[model samples]
Target: MPPPPNYPASARRNGEEGVVLLSFLINQAGQVELSKVLQSSGSSALDEAALSALSQCRFTPATENGKAIAIRVTIPYVWRLNQ
Candidate 1:
């Protein structure tokens, strides 16, 4: 999977950090569908970056009875500054 978004410079300078939770559907073809941010990281910049990262990734399609199926997944993105 692609690495999480790079920390926003402004956020880093301002000491902002938090987790962003998101909800989206993985389609039968292993493509993201209907992506949405379910929770914010308290910073719009961070949230957008997370979403952008997710958009660039392709998930493995779920399967049932030897057939590919869509699945709903929730992801949490955590951002923390190194000490």
Candidate 2:
């Protein structure tokens, strides 16, 4: 699974924190494809950062009947400002 995305600086200064749910397809070649936000964190910057980070992720593709297959997945990203 992809690690949590970095908190955006703009968001940090404004104290933005929440979970963003992303939906994407994992291709047979173990690549993240067509990523989009299924839910929002109430901040456009946070949402954009989450999508940007999600785009950089690579995954072990899902398998079916011993063969690699594309699968849709949802990932939740939590962004909290450090005190």
Best by TM-score: 2
Global lDDT of each candidate: 0.87, 0.87
Residue-level lDDT of model 2, residues 1-83, one tens digit each, is: 67677778889999888888999999999888999999999999999998988788888888999999999998898887863
lDDT of 1 at 63: 100
Considering summed lDDT, which 10 consecutive residues are worst modelled in model 1?
1-10
- Candidates' TM-scores? 0.90, 0.91
Model 2 — which ten-residue stretch has the worst lDDT? 1-10
RMSD of each: 1.5, 1.3
- Please list the residue runs of candidate 1 whose C-alpha ends up more than 4 Å from where it truly belongs after superposition: none
lDDT tens digits by residue: candidate 1, 1-83 = 44777888989999989989988889999988888889999999889888888887888899999999999999898889883
lDDT of 2: 0.87
